[model samples]
Target: MTMSITELEQALRALRLSGMSATMQARALQVAQHQMDFLEAFSWLVQDELDRRRSRLLDRRFTLSGLRERKDLKDFDWTYNARLPKREVLALGTLQFLDAKEDLLMIGPPGTGKSHCAKALALLAVQRGYTVLYREAHQLIEDLAEAR
Candidate 1:
């Protein structure tokens, strides 16, 4: 027989009270606490799956170690330049755009760090549990061409 939400919550509570570690208790608590909001709980599960996929795609071996080492976004000069107000705004806007599921466009002249900012934002997105893809415009075009 299928279990109801209250039954699932009771089972989870039992697991938590079974002398589990703090970590396990916390995990069990989340399951028990969200039983009433199944849709939100399901969305979190889907987001977690997407995050796992993105992590696999962005495995350390595949990333530029040097770029990944830069901890502060301010270290990049383009992040400060006055000419590109919109890109900077967009960088800041990522906070507002968290889990927004919208396309982002960054356009600029060559050597302007458009790619850098995009990479940084994509990294941030992944950290915030959103799925992300980072690719050069030319490479994406070529990929589409090959697919056709």
Candidate 2:
């Protein structure tokens, strides 16, 4: 017996396959249009579920990271500060220090993109499956004091 789309979606939801359930209607339309075969449709459904789970995991990580902005290193204005060590900043973006288990300290005068760069790097680290805690120097000191 063929299952109705609603029944199928209900079953998928029961199985906690939210991603597949969410895409099932669209995939069904594609199937009806002969745009996808059974195997292809099944693969797409599985991929959708995986993508949803991955996205959710990233979201949770970002929430736990205490990062307010979704910053990227590419958005930094290299031309604005010609004296900035572009090479070093780019190297930090590579995240080698993470593997080396080292800490970073970005010190510069006000309005020199210190916080911007740090936030960008922290965002990258969170995206790359790392847990991060972002805080300003004074905030860190306050947290330390509060802990004592």
Candidate 3:
């Protein structure tokens, strides 16, 4: 039996597949226009669901992280600090340290973009599905004292 688009969407929502439900009308249109076959449409719906879940997960992670600012390593000024090695700093974004279970420490004088790099790396970690807590040195000390 053929189901209406609304009925199919309701059924998908009931199955807890909101992602597929959301794109159902569009995919149906594509199918009706013969732009996509049934199997191809099914694949697109599944991919849409996966993408939605991944986006939601990233949003959740970002919310849980105490990051006040969204930073990207690419936004960093390589010319700001002549002593800072650009290649080495960019490599940290690879996040291999997370897999190896290692901690990162950045040390430098003021105006050296230490905080910027740290925050950017933390953002990267969050995007990669890792839990992150970001704090300045003073704030970190305060949190530690409060916990004691």
Which candidate achieves the best TM-score against the true structure? 2
Candidates ranked by lDDT, best first?
2, 3, 1
The TM-score of predicted model 3 comes to: 0.90
Clashing pairs in 2: none
Residue 144 lDDT, candidate 3, scale 0-100: 97
How do the residues 1-148 of candidate 3 rate in per-residue lDDT, one tens digit apiece?
9998889989999998999999999998899999999999999999999999999998888888888889899898888788898888888989998899999888878899999999999999998889998888889999999999
- lDDT (0-100) at residue 48 of candidate 2? 100
Q: Judging by TM-score, tell me the better candidate of 2 and 3.
A: 2
Error of 1 at 38 (Å): 35
RMSD of 3: 1.5
Q: Cα lDDT of all candidates, in order?
A: 0.57, 0.93, 0.91
Q: Stretches of candidate 2 above 4 Å error?
A: none
Q: Which sections of candidate 3 miss by over 4 Å?
A: none
lDDT of candidate 1 over 11-83, digit per residue (tens): 6457542222213334445778865355555556445545655566556533532234323355567545568
lDDT (Cα) of model 3: 0.91
Candidate with the larger TM-score of 1 and 3: 3
Q: What TM-score, computed on C-alpha atoms, does each candidate reach?
A: 0.47, 0.94, 0.90
